[model samples]
Target: MHFNETELPGVGKKITFKNSEGIYTVMILHHNGKREFYYLEDDDDDEPLFSTTLTSEETKELAIKLLGSREDEPDDDSYDHMSLVRKKALVNWVEIKDHSCMIERSVGEAQQMAEEEVSIVAIFREDDLLSKPSDDVMIADGDTLMVLGRKKAVEQFENICKES
Candidate 1:
């Protein structure tokens, strides 16, 4: 199974999962603690075959079940997609501290990520996740940024953020 994630701005994040059997599942996590689920027959289909919504608590329960308990014997079939993602790109969680160069600058001015081949995937602040942050979004002290890129580029970005 492969899952692709995208930011929906004012809405939330959208995650799509596809399996080799041509099955597709989409989950939209709203900022307001709601989740919408959709299913598609195949990639060519624009409309979902079925759709439903889940409350935040229900979603959490489902996630726990899917992840299983630590005691549960590891199954060979239970693969971790995060490891695959890490293999292809370096992901970092950087905190914007006092006096850091990133503190008050917008993403565009603070870090020209495209030129560096690095991408700021999300900003985590006060338990809220902002995915696909716009260039105008300003960084603030105490903000946690999630960035992705090749190792060297990611390190460069981190260095830029850490500068006083």
Candidate 2:
């Protein structure tokens, strides 16, 4: 997995190196938007602490290499149509905020929205982890909704929420 800029601190000081057999002499340094691996023990006195050439890809590769290769790197046959759907604009999306509506009529609105050829995939309560919310879900204050089916349906649903 690519570590985002936030996850890794792109900074370092000094440098040094020794390439010994059976042991890789390297550490990843990320600075600015660039990243790479480096030899921690090997540094010429002439070079500055901030000077080193390491790419994020190389660092990731060396790290993974230390952990051994994964046999499941190329496996993903679980969900049919998932690959294709992934290639297209994702149907799954979240509403920005929980807008109040008649709890009883919410489902009906969702249904009518669905009839317009859009589907109401799901509505999630706020504070949920966003992994997966269940069916028969209810909306409440601070709820985050997960909707799917079609773009048009989602837009219409939002519009109705705005109106109500």
Candidate 3:
């Protein structure tokens, strides 16, 4: 794959490339150590189909996972992208709505309500990220949960959250 880099003058640098699937990808490395990513249908597209911003630390973590560091190796329960597809395993984010049944419940209580094999990996509460949060942590409305499990189990967990 060929990569093209351009300077953004007062901003930083812009890198563009096409992945194996021929989807155009762009990365903007800001001077302040922030990274912005975008995907386009074509190189000349003026607007991105999707975009996201990542801090320096988050970018480094994503790089490590992509490059497969020894410490980041998958365990028995975890699978690579291809393996995950074959096993129907999934990692999903579920947001707690105001009317959801999970609201006001503790993390452990929500887990018990699902009664599935899903694992709540982390909870994103506004600006804070609670990684491997304790079971006693309250599940407030508007909290985003990162869960991992088989497709069916995860779906069941999502259904539990939607129940009132």
Candidate 4:
């Protein structure tokens, strides 16, 4: 990878990296803590094939994602690069109600996942995110579960969780 750093004068700093395959990846960091990312094909045109603007926080999050730091980090790839086959599956969110039957049950014990064919990918409780929770992790009231599966199976899993 060859990286070229240049100052954009009134804007900020711009860093461009050309990989071995000749793909150009550019990131421009503005003085206001905003950032712009660009992807260009290995061609003659200087225009970017894809671009997105990110805030300071979002920029940090994107850095973390690119670095593949931890398991809790969200797995998000630019939709521009996604293949058609990956666009079929759907991810849904289910909130566990306080009076629901799934409360106080461990993920393994509830068996909602096994029976419905839905997989729990992450759990959100208050300000915390529990990513790829183990079977021993207990489901709690008000916890939001990120479930991935076919549409029908996801709906079935939600119905099971929302049932009192």
Candidate 5:
């Protein structure tokens, strides 16, 4: 698989992933939390064969379904597809312990402190979930960080969270 990403000025971003069969799946992430998906038969084609839009919530649900959690594992035949997806990206949860260095730090501050690039997609605090929290959001002890990034970056982030 091959992928390309382009910034869309004030709009958001455009990402296109080419599968083994040469078909392209394009995803446009809008700044307003809307997502547009398109399928292209040829790389040079300007018009998509199919297109659809999804809200942020719907996007999250679709991602969850694609990832298949431990409690809702897909059938064995879907393992290969799942494996491919896992190899390309990773979504993980890192719990902030009492000794964590991230405690009390704002999300923006913590992101700059780390050498690796991993996105803090959401923060789970007991009964509440702060999705796509602002930069000023503070990290608290026992809060679980929902992070997304490459495998190596995510691993490095987990290690950073363990440091006092």
Candidate 6:
């Protein structure tokens, strides 16, 4: 089959601009100043009313991919395009916290944990949720890292590193 006939990894095709669901496909704008794929919902009159799509995986996939990419890299990169988000690594929590640590090593520690096959899950900056954490994001005094890893790994990473 041709590319159009098959499921392309990072692409969304407008399926019947007008459907019974009253949905139209429109691109969603992002804060980074990028236009991503989205399925827009419309009415029989084509009066676009609402659209709904994911900014990130409800799980660990997109979050991890987001962490892996450089802050300035274009979102067009294939690595940045995946339909299913990675599941956060299984983990345990002894205490609740956000950042990795205080020292410069904290950054490294975060990477190490990420590399260790444990997912950072979701990060929180105050009340705002940081699903995709940037490398340069500062580890302030009040941040929370939702870690996903093995019970031991999560506990160690949280108690000894992320939370301390």
**TM-score (all chains, Cα) for each model:** 0.46, 0.34, 0.51, 0.45, 0.48, 0.34
For candidate 5, the lDDT comes to 0.77
The segments of candidate 6 whose C-alpha lies over 4 angstroms from its true place after superposition are 1-100, 103-108, 113-115, 162-164
lDDT for 74 in candidate 2 is: 28
For model 5, the superposed segments whose C-alpha errors exceed 4 Å read: 1-87
CA RMSD of all predictions: 11.4, 16.6, 13.7, 16.6, 13.5, 14.9
**Candidate 3 local lDDT, residue 58:** 78
| Pairs of residues clashing in candidate 4 | none
lDDT of all predictions: 0.72, 0.41, 0.78, 0.70, 0.77, 0.43
Taking the tens digit of each residue's C-alpha lDDT, what string does model 1 give over 1-164?
77899976444578999867777988877553458888899856777899888765676567768888545544333333322334366566677899787888887676584356877789998768999999899988899898877655776887877789
Tens-digit lDDT track for model 3 on 1-164? 99999976434579999999989999987543457899999998877899998865677678778887848544434323322455554666688999999998988888877666877889999888999988899999999998777766777898889988
Per-residue error (Å), model 1, residue 17: 26
Instruction: List residue ranges in candidate 3 displaced over 4 A.
Output: 1-84
lDDT per residue for candidate 2 within 49-160, as digits (tens), equals: 3434534345446546777985443223422233234333224333444344524344445456444444444555544454443334444555545444444455466565
| Deviation of model 5 at 82, angstroms | 7.9
What's the C-alpha lDDT at position 121 in model 2?
A: 48
TM for candidate 4 is 0.45
Write one digit per residue (lDDT tens) for candidate 6, span 1-164: 11112222222222324445655555433221223444445324333455444443322345457689546543433433322223223332122334445434443356475334555545665557776565565555555565555434554565566444
